[model samples]
Target: METEDEAVQLPFVGSFDRRDGADALADKIIRTLSFDLQDFRRGQRPGAPKGFAYLRERVEAAGIFVLLIGNLGSHHSALNVELFRGFALADPVAPFVVINDQDSDTAWSFTLLHELAHIFLGQTGVSGSKAGTPVEIFCNDVAGRVLLPAAELARQYDLRDAPQAEVISRIAAIAANRQVSNSMVAYKLFREGLISHEMWAAVTSLYRQQWLQNRNAARVKENDRGPSYYVVRRHRLGDRLLKLSRRMLTEGALSPSKAAAILGVKPSNVYALTETAA
Candidate 1:
């Protein structure tokens, strides 16, 4: 992590004077552990490996948990209340990352990076309320810097003569690189004074309303999809348990009934609840 003096030399716009000592420490830790977005997006597996135990090991090892809080109103999917509650109760001291899908892909990506900033800053047990605090403000500043560096944005602004469509196109290009949304880029540009206040307000208002409507429609679709269950099993159980169980069944190390018993599932539901990686 760079010192305050060093951070100023970086592409970020905000100052670090807002942060206290503890917050600064958190920031350092986050910066140290941070991984490239491109690498992570490509490397991440599509689903939970094997079962709950495997999931815990991978998350604990990564030192961060990615919680995708989908908008219930738009998708009709039930809120992941259980997952949220579990994290809250599990460890008050450990770092936790939480992100909300506020309708737009752009908004969601910004919020996700914002939460990652909080993790890097070393704050624990954070939520939306903490966003207003000095530490959180610093974190937000860092996230913005990372997602849309001041230098790059300035170059883009120079390339256009303030035409709304041209500005949107530039923002879209930046968002594409960051895997974020155009609205997020637009807001960033507005904050930097590259766009007029009136333009900013109008575009933001329109985007917000559209996002709300789409989110509500998604909620209906989710409700129609019916029940889906996911479990968070003990970490000690590990991915090996799932793999070994499958191998044993194949090699005649154990009977199907015995494997089902060990896994604590009925014979019929074992296939549904248990999956082994190849």
Candidate 2:
């Protein structure tokens, strides 16, 4: 909820397209951020085998991250709020990002990476639509490059003339290895022209239905109470936001009331909220 005055002024004056060297800019930002995909593949760096913890750490370091606890339907799923630290209107380094929590894990992860690309590009706007605008395309390029690198896909499935069965099998194996959904893998393959459009559409539809079914089943099992309060809060706020708020609270730099405000909970609930995030 940063005011217009506090928003980061985009580095670009007008155009946000590949012609503007968006891809090169994205590559530079990735390198500068030190997001080592090779280390992630080796599982020798970052937090754990699953990579979300490491990604969260990098994201929090790059900017202020917030997870909005609400549905955005199939559109308007994520947003970025460019906030400048201090009152310096001239400063435009780091910004803020907010993402919807209603999407399935894979979709959520994709949106997260996409928004991070925006932050790196110094772009600001709501995300989540089927359009192929230049900025959207650029962000998608960045997200795909980082999350499901084309080179990795090439290494995983070297066969260029594989049968349908072999293609599906390879996609499933790669998705499992990457800890991402098969739909994501299929989409990337389609983009890479390694899979046919027909196959991609079929796989995407099947996975979408499967995800919806699983979500409905889980909701019925939970009786609509949803996840525990702390679990929800922890995920919504993320570890970095929680740890920073907790540290500020402990150091007396942030008042309990202010912490509560930032956390969207009562002052008395701040400690408990952060505890759940632990």
Candidate 3:
């Protein structure tokens, strides 16, 4: 539970109960900041860079923090609880912590964006009280509006007497288009009485089981590969920095050591950057 003063710091941004509502907050934030969300969704340069290091740089630049929340007993996993505490300690004012549920990219994306909405609303110190403090409730409402717009979702779901599978398919399609998860869409439908609670629960359970199975399979594959470090993406060094690096490399404005430091690498790795450019 949050104190009255703490609760007052949070702002309500958009509709949270409906399927399309959750995305509203993010949409509003993007627009307010004069940023095009499409720009963030684009592909990076091939073989440019990888790993969470790039992501961390982007988050720092954007004043956001992404925390990966994985299953218990998973080695090298990010713990959500620890992330929450860390963010609280690091930046008490407007700490932005995005949580990924480690279930699937879809779920992770949805939850991350939803949490981002909470940060945009200026809500902090939100404990896991599902009965949720007023501020939490308001944040949830904003998340709903941002993810599922009421009018838009209603129009899409208003087709004649759709079956559960059909409805789920449609919801899944919409979620995919919005870069969110289908379960989030179904949850919204159940909340709106578009789907029964039992149906929603059953679908959720199935997805959970599937996700667990896939994760186990992936673990086996990782074991087979031994210890191999994978670079996920590299363009995350900020567009400005990336351009500057390239220009400096051509004009000799940046030395190899300076370039390595800019990329968050040790001075010894300076050759790596030059080698890549070579």
Candidate 4:
């Protein structure tokens, strides 16, 4: 990865409203980053999410990407005011990303892509209330397409002959393979006219309910000893930030106090922070 001082420069000076505009911008970004569909898929190993690391590396190369585990009571707790959010700054000097980490992996993935769309579209503001806005809609379109390509969906499931139940089953299978929530698959299928809006609503609601139940169960289990502080923090702060902080500390470019402050921990905890790259 490139050094922070050598991060790539991406300048956004205007806005766009058209879906075509969003698609065009998405294409430009993929080309600029030399990213392909395989890069997204290759990192997605079974039971392991490697894409976030890939995204984090690129963010370190070109911008700041923050994973704020708000509900856990860190400085990011302010984000709990909203159910979820991901923001991209418009200020050129402060170009950065802040994504809520207290969501399901699928939801978080979508939010990340949604914010990336905002960065590409130069759309900067609180994302909570802009749901139906053209910019938001455009970003949603971009995000959905990026995660689950329309062409791939069309080729995988035949809406003409497959029964609705079978189609839903196929959707779930595909979603599992892709490591995204089935809700996303339902949305894509609905958009493709392969499923009814009613079906989409029902399926999305069902998945959300399942996710809630699973989360509650996991929370109960987590209270018993779940992951260590640093392990969880690794995901919240991301590998790029943690590794960079450790490197600076080792090179004498940063003091223990400053490193701890940057990492939101006490100076005494600096050693623990650098002990593992997790």
Per-model CA lDDT versus the true structure: 0.48, 0.61, 0.49, 0.66
lDDT of 3 at 200: 74
Candidate 1, residues 177-264, lDDT tens digits: the string is 4555566666677767787767766666766677679877876677534444423321112344555556666666667788778655
Name the runs in model 4 displaced over 4 angstroms.
Answer: 1-9, 12-20, 44-50, 72-82, 91-94, 156-167, 223-225, 247-255, 275-278
* Ranking of predictions according to lDDT: 4, 2, 3, 1
- Give the CA lDDT, 0 to 100, for residue 25 in model 2: 54
Please, what are the lDDT tens digits per residue for candidate 4 over residues 154-218?
A: 67644545556876687778787564678778877877888777777777777777977997797
Number of the top lDDT candidate: 4
In order of TM-score, best first, we have: 4, 2, 3, 1
Q: Write the per-residue lDDT of candidate 3 for residues 1-278, one digit (tens) a residue.
A: 03213222223332233334435555665554344334333423333212223333344345443544343434565454323312121243324453434446555433444455555544444333342356554555554554465665676544235666887677777766454466777766766667776787777777667777987798777744443221321322334344445556566667777777765656665444434432
Question: Highest TM-score: which candidate?
Answer: 4
Comparing candidate 2 with candidate 4, which one achieves the higher TM-score? 4
lDDT of model 4, residue 44: 57
Comparing 1 and 3 by lDDT, which wins?
A: 3
**Residue 63 Cα positional deviation in candidate 1, in Å, after optimal superposition:** 1.5
Q: State the number of backbone clashes in model 4.
A: 0
How many clashing pairs per prediction, in order?
15, 0, 27, 0
